[model samples]
Target: MKFATTLSLLLLLSSILVCTMSTPLSRRHSLSVIRKLNREGPFVGLITVYAPEENAFLASNAFKPDPRHPFVDLSGRRFRIGKVRGKGVVYVRCGVGLRNAVAATQQMLDLFNVSGVIHFGIAGSLENSLRTGYVSIPKQFAQTGLWEWLKANGTVGPEYFAHLDIGSYNVPEGEGINQLGHIGYSAEEFYSESGVPNVPRRVVWANVSQNWYNIATKLEGMELERCLNSTVCLPQVPKVVIGQRGSTANIFVDNSAYRDFLSKTLGVSLAEMESASVIMTSVANGFPVIVIRGLSDAAGGQDGPNSARALGPLAALNTAKVVIRFIELLPSHKKYQDLK
Candidate 1:
């Protein structure tokens, strides 16, 4: 009886050990298997848009949603994986804010084998030369919404609202005024060494990937649509331009004074809501990013509020066309494989 009891205990212990070995923990012990299952590779393109109009344009042009294609629903956000110009691509409508843009971009990085990102949408023209329907590929992106308070003594104080600085009046000498209150306020002129309250100006800037910039520079003069339907049209034919700075924020700017400020202060050629966020996120992930914006309105230039409504569709369509052309020109996967 004593021998039989000892044998039964040993058998039970052996069964437990066998069960543990077949579980997930044991399967994870092999490094090769873990890598093979988790590691994602090969380049998949990521295209992001912010508004419904932009989404409609992309869906009709490059990304025709197919029910057969795999669709991923994560955390109440939907991502459609499709083919664009014969290349595997994913389309995401990130909504109209910095938070949404960043979150969606990060999700793409986590779930897909993304090679690069391209942002396409409409923007208000900051540069006088960029008229309605003109497309611009910005080289640098900045946040216009960020503001630092300036004390009477010419020193940095605290943060303040950016819109408070917009207007067409001079900051009176000691009237508790904002320097950017007026158009033609030059940072270089105000912040000289001999100027009052000597402090370095604060501005954060993010640059596009050099490889992507090179590709954009070569895309100039590409055909763009300038007509709004059969009857409506721009005053002049629009063309693609490259290598300019753009600003992004949540603000929908319709004030010409602020528009001039952005152009003069930051050399911003275009102003929009989502590109800067996407660019920064791409930079953090060490992937190439490009922003192609079509001029939808003048941002309160002489065109008035109806300008965007009248021209927005044309701008979105032209921007989409440029993006499609860029994708067609991207280096083939074989080139990347050779490097590996």
Candidate 2:
């Protein structure tokens, strides 16, 4: 849900709270970057996680640049200020991992008069049916990295993923699953920021904007890339499946057992490292956002070697295709016009 302006202001008071100190680092950073750039727009933020993904987006024919100043620099980062499908867009590579994603996205929003955000990149498929090269525009994203290390005297959470939900993920914590030594995955808690005063909020899923989801849904059944090259092809044709819940974690998932745990517990179709942060930040600021992920591997369950080694570039290219199409279709939408 988008945070209300009144509630957003109230959150500043948290700096004086006893549970924590100071405002969220993103808020402070936002003020500084906005003051510095001081730009205007209804510009949509296009963010990607690393070079391969960014490069693919750049190569798209849809990335039409503003001839006068197609590129700009901010604090050593290069951002492409352009148009996608005739909609104003500012694209940047938000390096890998959760923290990097949060920082880079916040900077982009701060530097431009951004109306919304679109983040896309490669992912490891958590669902076996979602083969390598398939693109997933998940309706919701969850940060799976947040957890509580339950020890021998453990109790089920009011704070974390339930004991029943995370039981399979528990390692041999010096004893059996009944003991507190296991790790319990948890929902990330948002205090005061949830917009209701004095309430510490927790969520099982963070959502993307429905309007964006409506636009993205049109891409379903659109053709996807199925081959890395003539000979190196995926088992079958790639597809764009929308609305499945996806997940993210700072850790790269390469083990099948861990992947199964996430899929069963979270109903995740795809898993990656950065999009959850982007969605959370955008939601906090009341901007529409969406994440598109292409499966590069099967989260360690692929028949052969992890497909990402040879499949990353190909998967990224497919996501770029979907994103570009989405942007092209975005122009003149009732929702975006409201932003202007």
State which candidate has the highest TM-score. 2
**Each prediction's TM-score versus the true structure:** 0.73, 0.81
Tens-place lDDT digits, model 1, residues 66-126? 4453455555566666667876666677788778888888777665667778878888998
Candidate 2 residues 1-340, lDDT tens each? 3568767767866644743436556555644544443354667889998888887888877888878667776655777877887778888887889998888888877567777899999999998888889899999988888876766556666566644434444566323555435577788765423487667578768888888888889898998878767877877999999888887888888888878877886788888899889988887767789899989999877666887868899999999999888887776533674542
Model 1, stretches more than 4 Å misplaced?
Answer: 1-43, 64-67, 149-154, 157-203, 334-340
* Top model number, lDDT: 2
Model 2: number of clashes?
7
